[model samples]
Structure formats: structure tokens, C-alpha cells
Target: MQLEDMTLEELKRLRKDVEKAIETYEARQLSEARAKLEAQAKELGYSLETIAGVSKTGSAKRLPKYRHPDNPTLTWTGRGRKPKWFIDALESGYEKKYLEI
Candidate 1:
């Protein structure tokens, strides 16, 4: 069907189908590449994970850099999003140094 003749809904559907096809194509390509690499690594008597130094176990937990003044139990590593208590403390004029562990 001609692009000019297709209705708005049809055009939107076509766009969505195109996007999904692209994603599927890319994922299949990546899977094939990974499999080929794994096969090559196995032939060399080493797995890809070992050559890449990737561990199955998760990384160590980050220790808290800031602690709640009112409740010492509540703490934050100050890496990701700020906790509600931390936000409240900052809003109430509490400096970051005052919350340090």
C-alpha cells in the first residue's frame, strides 16, 4: 500500500510494526553474535565470562554515607535517589555533614 493512501491509524500501526521488527532483528543479531563468540571461546578452552572477568555473584553492597539524625537506623549510601528522610532533613535546614555516618 502507498504511504500517501494509508490512513493515520494505519500509518501508526505500520510505524509500530516497523519498530518491533527492528528490535526483533537487532536482538536476533546480538544472540547470534554472542553464540558465535561463546563457540569460539569454548574451542579455545575458555568461556566468554572468564575472558571478560564477569562474575555470576553480585557486587558488594555500598555502606551508608549519610544517616538520619532522628532515627539512626535510617541511612543512605548517597548514590541513587535521596530517601524521604534525607530530603526532609535537607528541607529542614540540616546540612549533609550533620547526616554523615
Candidate 2:
């Protein structure tokens, strides 16, 4: 533990180990706190997700950017790969604007 006895490499490695330990401790603390809160919420007839205002769905819902002309139920947020219907419309010479909701 003496600074004078430790080499530069040894000090660097020790720092890395200490940082990893701190990170692990912090993560465990956070998990424990979340579990405690969830247990309390459940006892009160509420879910942790509801109390935290977090959605079961991804972080948050993204509004649909496009809708099917014939079947309005079909929709997409233009995030990932296009859906089959959307590709079909494009292949049928329909412009992307026509799919906008």
C-alpha cells in the first residue's frame, strides 16, 4: 500500500481493480434499492414500473410515422427495417408520402 514501493504499472493495475470494485458495489446498491422500492410498491397495490412511471414497452412509445392506406391498423414508426406492406407499397410504385399518418 506504500506509494514509494509500488511501480507505475502496479499502481495503474491497482487503480483499475479499485475502480471495478467501486462499480460493482454501486451496481449492487442500485439493484437492492430498486428491489426494496418494488416490494414496498407491491404491498401498496402498485407496481414498481407504475410507481417509477416506466412503460412495459420500450423506454417510451414512439408515435407511428406511417399507416397503411387500406388497413389503418398497420403502422410503423420508421425506426427499423420496413414492414412487408410498406415494402409492397413501395414496389407497387406508391410514394412514401402516401403512407404518412
Candidate 3:
């Protein structure tokens, strides 16, 4: 049926369905991306479990200090919130350089 001929309620329902499909697609894409990242890390001599650094009891593993991009004067250990460096870099953006899995 033509969209113009559909009732408002029907249109809303269609929109909801489309949004749900998009959400599902996005979730699947994210899962794939994470799996790929894990695989790449493994190939680079890092285990996924170690990357996430979870203990036997499921506690977070220790993270090393990293430099902040926004404020070079500052450094972070990756334990707390997104460091200024990451936030700034993300805001500035860079080309998607994905490692092959």
C-alpha cells in the first residue's frame, strides 16, 4: 500500500517496525565489530579476556596509563571515565582504521 494512503496509526506502527529493524541491524553490527576487534587483538598477541582484563570473579583487570589527547598535560589509566584525550580525539575524529581479523 502507498504510504500516503495509510492511516496515521498505521504509519506510526510502520515507523516503529522500521526503527526496530534498524536497531537490530545496529546491534548485530556492533557485535560483529567487537568480535573482530577481539580477534585482531588475539592475533596481535593479546587475549580478549586479557584485553577486557576481567578476573576469575569477573572484576576488571588492571589498565595501563595512557596519555590524554585533548590535554597532553594530563594522563589516564583507563579506569575511570573516557579520558580527555579519547573524547577529544573522538570529537575531532579520524579515519576508521580497523585491524583485519
Query: Cα-based RMSD of the predictions, in order?
Result: 16.6, 17.8, 11.8
The TM-score that candidate 1 achieves is: 0.42
Show model 2 residue runs off by greater than 4 Å: 1-58
Q: Give Cα-based local distance difference scores for all models.
A: 0.71, 0.71, 0.54
Candidates 2 and 3: which is better by TM-score?
2
Write down the TM-score for model 2: 0.43
Tens-digit lDDT track of model 3 for 39-97: 99989998766777655353654433343322334545455786555566446442112
Instruction: Please provide, for model 1 over 2-73, each residue's C-alpha lDDT reduced to its tens digit, 9 standing for 90 to 100.
Output: 999999999998986665454345334544666788899999999877777765455846555676766667
TM-scores of all predicted structures:
0.42, 0.43, 0.35
Q: What is the Cα root-mean-square deviation between model 3 and the actual structure?
A: 11.8
Model 2 shows how many backbone clashes? Answer: 0
Alpha-carbon deviation at 47 in model 2, angstroms: 29
